[model samples]
Target: MIVAHWPPISATLCPKFSGHVNKPLKGLRSFTFNSSFSFKASFRCYCIKNENPNKISSEEGFSVLGSDIPWDSGSIWSTMAFYFFSLHIPFSFGGLSVVAQILHQPVIDPQTEALSILTLQTLELIGALLLLNYTAKPGYRFSVFRDVIINLGMSKRPQDRHAVGWSSPTAVNNPILKEILLSSNVSEIACILVYCIVTPLLEETVYRGFLLTSLASTMKWQQAVIITSAIFSAAHFSGENSLQLFIIGCVLGCSYCWTGSLSSSIVIHSLYNALTLTITLLS
Candidate 1:
């Protein structure tokens, strides 16, 4: 009886493997292995990135057209959490409100209102973008849009485009928000910045853009929409405002899911806020 010993397969043997790997399935890398014995055999090995057979597509949230939101569900959650604590600690009312009270400027805060509230919105947006850029994959940073103008322009119809990701998985809206400071000394400019510009951009980006879009990649998109819209509503937090905000959130969420971009929602949000503020001021 002859017991033949075989050397461990090395990388060099891969070249001689006769199996042909066709264009691999999405999220799959194919490897070929060969064995020489009584009969030659070729084996194909596939390393799958999205291994789940039940993973849903983003576009399927409303239709089969597909999702434009990039990043996996895991990345979505991690980034959302990171974005929240990083911004919330510095910018939210609870945060700066404490500093204002301590500084004895609670009643007359001209400088703080201007510096920390009015101007700070721009800084916060810049910081959020920078953070997103840092965490995004190699080629795509804020690659969520078909066109950059779409975030600020008119709505575009949904298409058959899909998102690419390092792995597969799924936001509700952000909880951090901007609001009109009730202090008598708070500037109208600060209110404008918070409502017209800051609130719409920050909230919409967090809620409709990232949160809602991320959830679009799931099987239960309707639930995701309702949940995210509810979160957006809760951030405003008032017995009177809750129902109104919830309705608005539903509209924004549906607009995003249908139009496949943030522009329409942002426009609507900005307009509604501006109108409400204007009416409040006039009255």
Candidate 2:
């Protein structure tokens, strides 16, 4: 039986098949059953698994392409794993914020309240960095800062290039953002410093580093990027402004794809967040 399918396998599956992988059919273009030869050729080698003479070798196999792509079928399990186990930034930050609110006044003073917010944010940021470094494989360990900048200048989009780099740019250009960026004051400056120092490192790792990469493994780059960006945006829902939080999530997601450097994205993210926080504090 010979199975002929267009693009026998998806481009994303290329990486898994390229090397000696534990997964079956790891790196072959397609599967074909030749009863006469009764042999299987994969990678650069040929293997002969004994076959029954009575078996119909002409049994047709389905194509692994089109909407039925294997990567898109059930790869979401990996994404969920990373969301909870590796990239816990969203969960951590949300938990901290809730804790802050619940413990406010009763267990903490005004000064302590501010300090706790800062502390929680700081811990979340650290966890994001550590998660990216430790959880992701080295082959995929991209720098959010460097990679994102490079991507911006590149002529090709990830979808066009047949590569699932990261999530799309969820940040929309808003006039208010410009105004926010332009304003500056002392308290705003302090907030900006904290934001600039914290967000990029933390957010990028959580959204792009862990979430994007994990989703990309099972889903197409486009689908993975969209899903991850949604989750990233959702994490900020507890904040007062849902619209702005989603915008920030998109921007951070795109920044990661464009730069590929977790650190660089952190820098840019930190700067943006700091500016916003500063403006909020000063206003």
lDDT of 2 by residue, 137-170 (tens): 4553455333433432111000000011111112
Best-performing candidate as measured by TM-score? 1
Clashing pairs in model 1?
Answer: 59-66, 59-67, 73-170
Alpha-carbon RMSD, each predicted model? 21.0, 20.9
Off by over 4 Å in 1: 1-65, 98-104, 110-115, 142-150, 153-186
RMSD of 2: 20.9
lDDT of 1 at 171: 9
Residues 106-149, model 1: lDDT tens digits: 44244354445544455556555565556656566656333332
Least well predicted 10-residue stretch by lDDT in candidate 2: 154-163
Q: Distance (Å) between predicted and true CA of 15, model 2?
A: 48
Question: Residue 202 error for model 1, in Å?
Answer: 1.4
Worst 10 residues of 1 by lDDT: 163-172
Model 1, residue 66: what's the lDDT? 51
